[model samples]
Target: MKKLLCIVLCLALASSLLFACASPAATETTDAAATEATASEAAATEEPAATADEPVTITILRPGDEEKVKSFLEPAVQQFEAENPNITVEIMYESWAGWIQTYPTYFEADTQPDVIFWWDNKLYDSSAHDHLVNLSNYLSEDFFSQIPQGIWDLVDTGDMDGVYYVPNSVDTFVMYYNKDVFTAAGLDPNTPPTTWDELLTDVQTIYDVTGTPGIGIPAITGSEVLEEFVGLFLNQATDASVLDSSSMPLFNTADGLSALTMVQNLSKYAQTSPTEYGRGELRALLRDGQVGIIFDGPWAVPTFKAAYGDDLDNSPIGIATVPLAANGKKIDWAGTNGWIATRESTAAASAKLIEFLMSPEILLSHHIIYGSAPLYASEFDNAAFQYDYWKVFYDEAQNYKLYGMIGRNSATPAAYYTALEEVWQQLVLGQISAEDAQAAAAAAAEGVTARNN
Candidate 1:
């Protein structure tokens, strides 16, 4: 009986040991399963990190000749795409005239391009002004530092708090002369006019000697060219803006009267039917040697180059700074065009593309292709800018108090131009005295101010 009881005890002890060992193995397996399940659940709930190769697409447009813009932009777009891989860029081409008419519609529909080539003076008056993403938030200080402070001030309308435009093109006016016309007039080609009196004398001499209009005045009745042409004289005479920041008529002052009188005196030698011609017509006349002088911007370079080739700066064309007023302040009428990113969703990529476009190498090429004055100080060193013609433009950009369009901040920015055109035409045609013209212009400006401000 004792041997049987001992055997039972031994069996119970073995069973207990087996049970303890099996329990531990089962717990270990359960723990391993729980860890695996927890990891799977975690992966299911959490998102994977985004890779650099994520797809994105953005569209861009510049209002200009489609062929010319595409010629330079298509290759740049290809390079940009290759470098980015994840981003696709599409260029929406529109002509200047057509875009001017259609842009308001695009802005109203929220269908404007992701990135746009825009006018600085007109931005405050456009629908896109409110839609533009503040570029200051995306562009770095280093990028802003590359441009001059004067340029930034030129584009500021005082209507906005942040930088919305990235000015790539800065343009100022200079007087372009035909050397042949100067020689025919018995005036030295190398010695162009230096003052308002000299300019008038030279125009008269050229008209008397050559029997051709000495200067082409672009006073097309509904166009802005006349306003710009007269505004330069006003800026030079008054040493002030044509319209104050409040869009009031600054051109109705005594200095403004003197400027108008100067324009009237000079008009004696200008082309017949001045109201029929625009700046483009005048430039064409200058290029053909039919007009002795025209005040134009750097955009005239390419046209003259195509016509004259290597002799552009030599015997045929003579470029000089716009003649000084009696006050001798070096002031000029200037304008700017730049890039603006409109869509908030694509602002990041749009800024990236703008940065790429504004890079020194790319910007230089753009300036060359667009025939614009160099915006960067570093660009002056480029071989393309080494010419004497470019030097005149560069110096003017450096020295002048560059003023923008009149009524730039007005609700109807074109009103200033329209208001002055008829009265200016009358002044040039001798239908009204300069004093009367001044009053008419003032009344028109007051009407615009009342309606717009």
Candidate 2:
């Protein structure tokens, strides 16, 4: 998630609860609410109800190292399994912290997963690069083509060698702020900033008048955080790649330097750079009114809604597309989540299942259940997608440039981002000239490239 925005389109399950007859998952204790999947032993003991012809065991694996898999996802699987007797899903959860080691060992073994969970763009690339089965074999062209044009764009990521992935739901980055804080600072809550310049000015104003941070800037999400939006800004101004693997040191262009300088300079106005604190901590600052703005994905909407309520509409919340670079249109850096066949898959069967998953009705249910945006027009039939809060993402989706998790561990990606962070810190700390920091960062990047290469 730190490598790119993972919050947009992630999910599972359907509930049959109708009207007042429903027993929400919340009826359980807090621990059970966290993750209620029955263990293999527990399942054996219960003789649980299942679909007519459930598989002996339908294994599902996902890597997040996040607690949400158990808390939020397990219940969905349980409910689905209850209705589908032949398809009892056995979820194997693992965290991202040790995933680099655990994943290969688990997936490569005889027990490969039938369905998997992943952060859309990053996981797709890693799986594709590793020669995971091409997902195209699992779904039809008509089906893929029919996915809302914008959501489908996420899977392409402009690589085009092959359609290695398909994003099932839609998602993007937006500026989330506390309207009450804005009001206290005498800024207009109804008008969130649209340009990078306005954002800067707003931050300084908030800090000056309210003694609260103007914003929370995160370098931890990696360069893609700024690179995706800024790439559009600068390239529209003058053509450039954030990192050019075509050359030795990746991206060290004048434009690249300028992007870093601009972002780093803003650190002086930010409450804290994200690398110094976990992302949840930063969001908490926004909720508690310590910070006025944070660049986050659609997931923050529900979180703030639950935590603040009327505060969200009155004193508390607002969501808008990420601020635009002067020359670029407002855009989001979105990712995808979908099914992929394994190395020895049966193409026909895989294709059928993929088709089932892509159905519009299923897509709508999935997104609604997870608080995600749907990737197909079929979902818009549900009243939820019509909201203004959701429209911001829909608008951003049209202009988004989906990002892969390439920079997480790779030299070009890491160095380029690290350079941006160090440059920002230096400029904020008044330790080096902007030009000097860019040059030095580029030099250091060259060394990282040579060594990694």
Candidate 3:
């Protein structure tokens, strides 16, 4: 009876041990199922696909007409967006009217765009502030190497200072002439007048043969007036010495009087009284072949091209460097406008956009459409930018000079420009002598400096 009881006890103990071992396996299986269910729920809700709720957008503020933006900028933006699926570009246009008043307000409000198109005017002054990004640290050395060292020097304020802007286009003056008119005048259309004296002779010949005026220069008091006397003729005479080293007006001198006298002499061959012609009228007269020559900027190429078609390059119309001085020295007055990224922007992304826009292919296309000289050095070598009309003025970019105010400490040029304009109109109308014009210009500049002080 004792042996039977012991065997039952042993069997019970073995069963208990087996059940304890099995309990851990069952718990582990249940935990595995729970973890799988939790993972399934997480997969179902895993943050909804990137939608309108979250978008990465870059904004650019530029100044231009809608037609221009649609024609040139929109396509480029579209390509950028297409390539960068996670990013979008929004372009906002500032109106041409009152833009100067409106642009600075954005910075004041701390609402400037990620990228902006700005001129050298007052930008160098602005660079002293913290409003602009320090591009020296952000841009790679290879990128800066692509642009001319002179241009980099043009924008650089100092050795430690940053490059606040990247130039997109450069502009300079050139004389456009009707080759057909030159040919009719018994002058070789292929050989343009190389000196001021030669230009005068050619003008007389064109007048004698064609019975039309030799040249059309704006004599009206406005921006064109200021540009002709102060922008072009003044610089040509003084070798871009419009201002003294001390940043004082230097145009009230013998050189300045000489420049004015030259302008006066040229006026005798004008198609109409300088007062009677505006830039538009002159361009129209030139287009209709009513005038032999007109001094204008590079921006007018498309207008001339449209009027003359293949003849623009073939022969009917041609571009020439402004006639040289007797000493064989020539200087071109130029202005540069460029893209600036604000300190408030995403500098990395804004820089990328500039890099993309300034690429050889993109810049070439933009310059082709805009009719301005390309900002990059290599772009000059590109055949697309080498149309005959372009080459005539394009090479001059190498030897070009910027406006007086391009320097860091130069005074406000526009302040005196109005007075200069009034003086120019008087001179062109024979109301004021060259010496008188210089005196008046000096007084005007003095008044501006006094007011600032």
State the local distance difference test value for candidate 1. Answer: 0.85
By lDDT rank, best first, the candidates go 1, 3, 2
Evaluate residue 162 in candidate 3 and report its C-alpha lDDT on the 0 to 100 scale.
Answer: 68
Task: Report the C-alpha lDDT of model 2 over 138-175, residue by residue, as the tens digit.
Answer: 45678867866655544543443545455655666778
Report the lDDT tens digits of candidate 3 across residue range 1-453.
899999999999999999999999999999999999999999887633333224566788767776876677788888877766666788887665656667657777877777877765555344224577766666778888887765654553433366778887777678888887888889898898888789888888898788888988786655634445345677777775565533467777677677878777776677766777777778878887899998877777777777766346775777888887555666766666788877533666677678778777788888877777666656668765656667666666656554433233333545555666787777767788878878887787667666756
Candidate 3 regions off by >4 Å? 1-56, 81-87, 124-130, 153-160, 228-230, 244-247, 375-386, 400-413
lDDT of each: 0.85, 0.58, 0.70
Error of 1 at 33 (Å): 36
Report the C-alpha lDDT of model 1 over 1-453, residue by residue, as the tens digit: 999999999999999999998999999999999999999999989644333356768899977887889887998899899999888999999999998899889999988898988887776765767788776777878999888777787886576778788988888999999988899889999999989989999999999999889999988877888888888999999888888888788878899999999999889999999988988888889888899999989888888888877346674889999999998888888988999988776777888889889988888988987889887778879877877778777777766888887766765787778877888889988899999999998888888889774
In TM-score terms, candidate 2 sits at: 0.70
Candidate 2, which segments miss by more than 4 Å at Cα? 1-58, 64-90, 96-101, 107-111, 119-128, 156-161, 219-241, 245-251, 272-275, 310-315, 383-386, 400-430, 444-448
| Candidate with best lDDT | 1
Cα lDDT over the full model 2: 0.58
Number of backbone clashes in candidate 3: 0
Stronger candidate by lDDT (1 vs 3)? 1
Candidates sorted by TM-score, best first: 1, 3, 2
Give per-residue lDDT, candidate 3, residue 150: 57
